[model samples]
Target chain A: MVEFGGWDMPVQYPAGILAEVKAVRKATGVFDVSHMGRLYLSGPKATDFLDWVLTGSASTLRVGRARYCMICNEKGGVIDDTIFYRLSEDRYLLIPNAGNRSAVVAWFQRWIDEKFSPGCTMEDVTVTTGLIAFQGPGTLETIDQVADTPLSGMRPFSWTESAIQGATVFVGRTGYTGEDGFELLVQGNDVVKVWTALTDSGSVPCGLGARDVLRLEAGLPLHGHEIDEKTTPIEAGLDRFVRFDKDYVGAAVLKDQQENGVQRRLVGFTLPGRSAPRAGYNLLHQGETIGAVTSGSYSPTLDTSIGMGYVLERYVESDTVLDLDLRGRIVQVNVTALPFYTRPRRT
Target chain B: MSPDDRRYTKEHEWVMIEDAAAKSAVAGITDFAQDQLGDIVFFELPKVGDSLTHLGKMGEVESVKAVSDLFSPIDGVVTEINEKLLDHPELVNQDPFGEGWLIKATMTDISQLDGLMSASDYDAFTAGPQ
Candidate 1:
């Protein structure tokens, strides 16, 4: 077990990190994501309240649908990237990163009072709930064995509540892996049962060790490691999630950036050798420091070193050659588009 | 064989002496060292002709977690460096005693190996007092 954000979480099973990584890439693996925070917001003006708080257009989501959104600070910088589920007309659930739960919740409460109707109520449901993500090609089969409800009709980013072991649980069609999977949210007491149910049926128990590699290979962004308060969604190649058509916080700054263009854009690259460029590595051009690596690792699937970093916009073009100052040694890297690996999402 | 009677360095490296020819010795990291490193993705090694002091930072072994310094067990001039680690570093994780073996160096002074821990002693040192 490893200490992460004050929580003792398993880094790998006895099967080992490499085995867990390959298992997820080849078959199915289950992850205990109970550390993530889940919040519930309800009130007459909940939609209006969320519309003012999140970057995406809240008006577009229908009941029972979830939208991937970003919460930005007053200065137009990202506070947290989250998924908001519109459970009903007045009830919404937000899933935030585990480490940023308190900060994000406080940010929302202060803003809601300043901008929304007084009927709104905010509740932090993280401690009361347990979250699990089953990701890989064979997740459906594995889930079918334990979950009482059939998940055939569930589409990506959609969720449905069902009873498992007499407890209310939420199963959403979402995952960090670039594969078709489900995120199960249940009562805190039932967490162990759900985790055991999946693992008992031959599914491997993956830890954060393999989780990092899987998400990296899929080109998903990680907070603190990849994105931070200084990073805007526009510069991170996530402009699709920002809706400028509606008035929202950070929209004006993003609009200005769109008009004037961004200074640095995040790009993916593969190292020339197997040596991985870790976070905080420097990116150089013509032997001069021009960018910095946010995250990198040796991809277990692609069998190469891959990394992501913010480079000057001019250098973000595909096929641009760059150098990574890895521990004072210069290593060659080629700028590639997002997602160095492009296997189809396991449906 | 287990080197049934070879001496080991505290850093999880082994030194096997060949008495037949010139009093020479071969050295490499032990099984315990490779197991702790997980998967070695890259190796930065010294050349065969490179000379070293008693204990030098001869090379590095990089795994998925981080890069670690590989220390010279018995010191002299490097006789041979494992060229295979340049392309297939995972071999180190697979067989640290054989093809995954790191380097061979001729001892500058025969007494250098005296300070190194024995196989049982090294195992205890690596295993931490238990």
Candidate 2:
């Protein structure tokens, strides 16, 4: 176990990281992601407030729907990546990384106070909620055994609130892995019950170890690993998630950046050998430094080395020949596109 | 759990010598090593027919948490590599001493075994090296 964002979480179980990763990729693995923060926003202006604050089109969110969004500073720099859910006309749920929970709450509080919404009120309910992700191909069957509602009817990026183990909980058809899965949000006090039930019932208990490889395999950007305050949406290749058509805190600058085009952009690549190129490894093109790697690992699924990095816009094209400074040696690399692993079953 | 039939090293590698035609020694990492590694992801193996020095760095093993250098516990030439590990590295975690055994080398010098700590000695050394 290691200390992550004030939580002591296991990096892996006795099954080892690779086994847990393969289990999730080929079958199913359960994760205790209760460390993630969950918040509730209530008021007549809840939907309007989120639409104004987030990058995605939250205005389109109907009750019982959720969408991914990024909260940005006025400079268009990401403050925290979050998921927004519209539970009702007067209520919404915002989930953010545990490390940035305080910052996100403060941002919402300040923004709402400054804008002065007559009905909008934000409450940080992170401590009251427990999050779990059961990911992989077999997750549906595992969840079906316990969930009162049929999980087969739920679509990707959608969710349903149902009763489980006599407790009201919300289940979302979303996961970090690029597989069929569900993320359950239950009350904190009910965490042990749900966890025990799932484990005793045969779902694999995975830890942070496989959680990372699964996300990396899916090409999903991690907050501290791939995205941070130093990186902008344009440079992270996350501009698609940013809505320029709508007015938000960072819209003006992002619009200018969009028109001018960012000088550097993120790209994914595969190492030529079994050796992995790690973060901070300088990316070189034609013997000149272009950028540095953000995250790198030996992809168990691809059976090759893969990584994500930022490179000069001109050098971000597919098939670009690049070299990574792996320790004192220069390792050859090929610029592949994001999502090194894409299973047909993911759809 | 250390098996009495197998010999152990302070570095957490185990070896079992058989008086076969070539006096071969089979080696694998201990459960303690796998426990510390958290999860085994990739294995970099030495090529077949490559000569290795006892206690020398032979290859590397990578896990989600960190990477570790695999050292040869006995000097000899690698007769076979666990090619199956190239695809399923988790076998090292599942059965570190059985099918997960990493390499089989012909013993060049039996004297090399003198330097390795016994199972009890290895356990003591691992508890906190003196």
Candidate 3:
């Protein structure tokens, strides 16, 4: 066990990290993501408030839908990457990373008081709710066994209200593992029942270790590593999630970056062997340091070492050769495209 | 419990004198060391003919979780590294005391083995704190 975001969470189960990662990529796995913050926003000006705070406009999001977005500072640095769901015309549920939960709530409260008070109200239901991700190629089949609603019609990023083992829950066709999956949100008291039914029907119980590896393989950016308070969304290669058509907190700075282009870009690289490049390792081009690695690991699925790091924009193209300083030993690394691993089912 | 046939070092390395008169010895990390480093995936070992310093870092072993330094228990000249570990590093977790032996070396001073801990002493030393 390890301490993550002030919560004692399992890094891996008895099956070990390799087996846990394989389970999710090949069959099915479930993650207890209850530590992620679940905040409910509602009232008359909810859409307006969200449009001002989030990079993506919640005003255009229809009810029963979700969109991935980032909350950024005035200077365009990312506060946290998140997903918000439009539950009703005036009500929405936004989920934030566990470590940034308190910060997000405070940010929203400050905005509500400054601009949208009396019309917007916020409720923190994290402690009362439980979130679990059931992810894999055959996830819909397994989730259908427990969920009382027909989930086949739900498109990616869409959600529906349902019942699981006699408990009311929200089932969303969303996941972090780059697979067809369902994220189930239920009352805290009903978590165990829902978890048991899914496991009994055949879902491997996974931990946070596999979660990190799977996300990296999918080319997803972790908040503290890839996009932080000092790193802008454009530099982190998250431009797709940023909407220039909408006015938000960091729109001015991001718009300028979009027009002028970023100085550095986040890129992916692959090493020849299993000795993976680690975080903080320097990237060198012609004996001069150019960038540093953010996340890396030995990829069991790809049978090679892969990593993502920020490099000068000039060195961001495919087949660009760079040297990774691995603890003083220089090893050659080749810049590959983001998402080193794509599911065979997807393409 | 640590095995009785070999001696141990503070860094959790175990060395067995294969042939004392021939100045030859074999060294590997202890069972406790492998257990602490779960699922080792790669090893960077010293090449044959490289000299090792007593209690000095000889190589590194990277598990799926973290990378850890491997320390030499005795001053010696490297004779051979375990070639099998290149592809199957998990042997260190499966049979740490046997097939997981890391290196074969020629001891520079036989007296270095006398200063090492016995099996009981090593068991007691590792039992304290962490």
Candidate 4:
């Protein structure tokens, strides 16, 4: 176990990270992600307030659906990458990274007080809720054994409120892993029952270690690693989430970046051999340091070392060769596409 | 289990004298070491015929979380390496004593083995201070 976001969480189970990762990629795995913050926002002006604050246009999001978005500071730097779920006409659920919960809550409260007064209210629901992700190709089959409604036909990013053994559960067809999966939001007290039911039905109990590997393989940027308080969404290659059609907190800066290209871009690269290029390693071109790695690991699926890092904008294209300084040894790496792994489509 | 015939290093490497007349020995990381490393993904081995000093850096072994330096327990010249680890690094995790053996070396001086701890002493060392 390790301390993550002030919570003692398992890094891996007895099966270990490698086995857990393979299980998720091939069959099914479950993750206890209750540490993520759950914030509830509701008011007469909820949609308008979300439009002003979030990068994605929440005004158009219908109930029972979720959209991946980011909250940026006035300078356009990302405060936190989040998911906004429209639970009701006036209420929305904002899930943020665990480490940024307090900060995100404070940021929302400040915005609510400053702009949308009288009607807006924000509540921190993290302590009362338990979040679990049932992921991989076999997720639907495993969840079907316990879910009251069959989840096989649920579209991605859609959610439904249902019951599990008399306890109310919010099930969403959303996941951080690249695999098809479902995320369950249940009352804190009912977490164990829900977890046991799925695990007994064939979902492998995984830990945060496999979660990191899976997300990395999927090319999903992590909070502190890919997007942070100092990085703008444009530089992070997340401009699509920044809806220019609507005005937002950092709309001007993002719009300017869109017009004039960003100086640095997040790019993916793969090593020629087994030597893993870890975070803080330097990316060099012609003996000059261009940028540094953000997240890297030995990919169990690819059977090679792969990583994502911010490099000079010119070096962000496919087939661009750069030297990764692992410790002191420089190894050649090829700049590849963002997602190193993609799940096979079920036709 | 740690073998009685092998001498152990505090760093978790084990050396067993293979030919006393030629001052030759075989070395590998212990089972405890592999267990601590979780999954072995890569091994960086020193080339054969390389000279190493007692307790000197030899190579490195990388797992999912970290890359740890392997150390030589005695002054020796490398005779052979476990080339199989180049392709199947998990051998260290699966069989640390047998197929996972890292290197074979001809020691410059056999007396350096006296500095290493016995298997029982190593067990106590790993168990932590009482």
Winner by DockQ: 4
Docking class of 2: acceptable
lDDT on C-alpha atoms for all candidate structures: 0.81, 0.82, 0.91, 0.91
Segments of candidate 2 deviating more than 4 angstroms: A345-347, B3-10, B14-28, B38-41, B45-58, B71-91, B94-116, B125-130
DockQ for every model comes to 0.58, 0.41, 0.60, 0.70
Residue A299's lDDT in candidate 4: 90
Tens-digit per-residue lDDT, B66-106, candidate 3: 88999999998999999999999989888988999999999
> Per-residue lDDT of A230-310 in model 4, one digit per residue for the tens?
999999999888998988898999999999999999999998667788888999999999999999999999988999999
Q: DockQ for candidate 4, please give it.
A: 0.70
Supply the TM-score for candidate 2.
0.86
Clashing pairs in 2: A17-B39
Give residue B108's lDDT in candidate 4 (0 to 100): 92
TM-score of each: 0.93, 0.86, 0.95, 0.96
Interface RMSD of each: 1.4, 2.5, 1.0, 1.0
Better of 1 and 3 by lDDT: 3
* lDDT tens digits by residue: candidate 1, A1-347: 67875578987776666788788877789999988899999999888888888889666898878888788875668888998888888999899998889889888889788887487889998898899988887887777767778774688889898765566679888888776788999988999888888788788998887888788888888888667789888888888888887777788987777778899989999976678888889999998888999888888788889999999999999999999998888888999998876657444
Extract clashing residue pairs from model 3: none
Chain B TM-score, all predictions listed? 0.85, 0.91, 0.98, 0.96
lDDT by residue (B1-114, candidate 2, tens digit) is 577667787667888886655678888899889878865777887988999887788888877677788998888999888888877777888888787889888888766676
Task: Give the per-residue Cα lDDT of candidate 1 at A61.
Answer: 94
* Model 2 residue A269 CA deviation in Å: 1.4
